[model samples]
Target: MSFITINNIWQEYGDHVVLERLNLQIKEGEFCSMVGASGCGKSTFLRLLLGQEKPSRGTITLDGKRLVAEPDSHRGVVFQRYSVFPHLSVLDNVAIGLELPQSPLLGRLFGAKKRAAREQAAEMLKKVGLGHALDKYPAQLSGGMQQRLAIAQAFIMQPRVLLLDEPFGALDPGIRKEMHAL
Candidate 1:
């Protein structure tokens, strides 16, 4: 069976239609890419696949189950625009995703757990070439740096399915190559 299935999917906003009769099947451990002109609903389709929005018609299934109507940890997403928290320091931004799911009540991890989470976040940031900017706020970083931080944040969760929208558009060629290696 397909790992992800999109059948007769359509997304329409009011009188306008963004996607029409979109169908796809992806096997387990497959990588798929969507290419189209701007405003052709690629991002919108990603959002739908992430369960951030339900299609105006049709259904999406992951592992033979209907996708939930809301976002969940089973999927991670890096939007085309940077989605890091502007108020958070770079390290905290990445660590928060790890902390929240493990400790939902406090929205944090304490003691050694906290330390481990931070360490993991730091390692991911380092892989993305942001090791020196751990204490810096998102607003203080360049657009490419912020986007890299966002990537680190999304990946640290180790979600079963990852959705990226123009995830490397802001990076330099060298940095993009480094990111692709991950």
Candidate 2:
């Protein structure tokens, strides 16, 4: 059996049909990519995988179980638009997702635990070429920097599946290639 399966999938909005009778199966450790023109259902399919959208008809299963309505920690996403926390610094923004799921209290980690989370967030930001902006808020960063910050935030969570929707759209080719390397 495949690790991820999409069976007889169809997505529609009112009178418009985006995807029709699509069937796909991906086994464990396999890599998959979808390519198509604009307005195609690639984004829709990704959204379905991310649990951001439900198929009009059919099922999408992961590891032999069906997907739930709400998105889970098992899946991570970096959207095309900016998804940073304007109120928080870059370090806090990146560490927040990782901190929340593991923390027993109301997303608060103190002392060494807090320090470790911040250190990890800083390292992730450095890897994504946003090290210098650690103290800055999301508003201070440029579009590409903001996108990189978002990527760092999502990647730090170490989710089972990472879904990126035009994640590098705002980055220059050189920086995009660098991100691909990381």
Candidate 3:
């Protein structure tokens, strides 16, 4: 059996049907891509898998367990726009997820734990080629750099599944290729 399964899925908003009777299976450690014209069900399918939206019919299961309706640390996501925090520095933004599990109310990671999170965030950003922009605010970076930061932020959490929603929509070809390499 596959690790992720979508069985006879259906999604709709009032009278508009986005997805209908879709069946898919994804195995562990496998890479899958979805391609279609704009306004197709690609984003909807990703959202369903992420539990951002529930199926109007049928079921989605991960590892044989039905997916719940809420966002959680088990899933990571990067949207095309507004993925980064404008107020936080790049390093701080990347470390936010690392801090969350330590304290739900305050996220008061300090001393070595804080430093370790910062180091890991730096490594992740460097992997995505954003090391030099660690101290810069999101608004100070270019569109492509911002997207890289978003990817790093998502990756730092080490989520079981990563969902990207048109993340490369605004990048030029060269930047897009670089992002693909990361």
What C-alpha lDDT do the candidate models reach, one value each? 0.93, 0.90, 0.87
Of 1 and 2, the candidate ranking higher by TM-score: 1
Across residues 94-181, which tens digit of lDDT does each residue of candidate 1 receive? 9999899899899999999999999999999999999999999999999999999999988998888989999999999999999888
Which pairs, if any, clash in model 3? none
| Tens-digit per-residue lDDT, 140-176, candidate 3 | 9988888888888888988888888878876788878
Clashes of each: 0, 0, 0
Q: Is candidate 2 or candidate 3 better by TM-score?
A: 3
Each prediction's Cα RMSD? 1.1, 1.4, 1.4
User: Lowest-scoring 10 consecutive residues by lDDT in candidate 2?
Assistant: 27-36
Best by lDDT: 1
**lDDT tens digits, residue span 1-182, model 2:** 89899999999999999999999999976777788898899889989999989999999999999998889888889987759989999999998877887796888787898899999999999999999988999888899999999999888988778888888999999999999887
lDDT of 2 at 39: 89
TM-scores of the candidates in the order shown: 0.96, 0.93, 0.94
Point to the candidate with the largest TM-score.
1
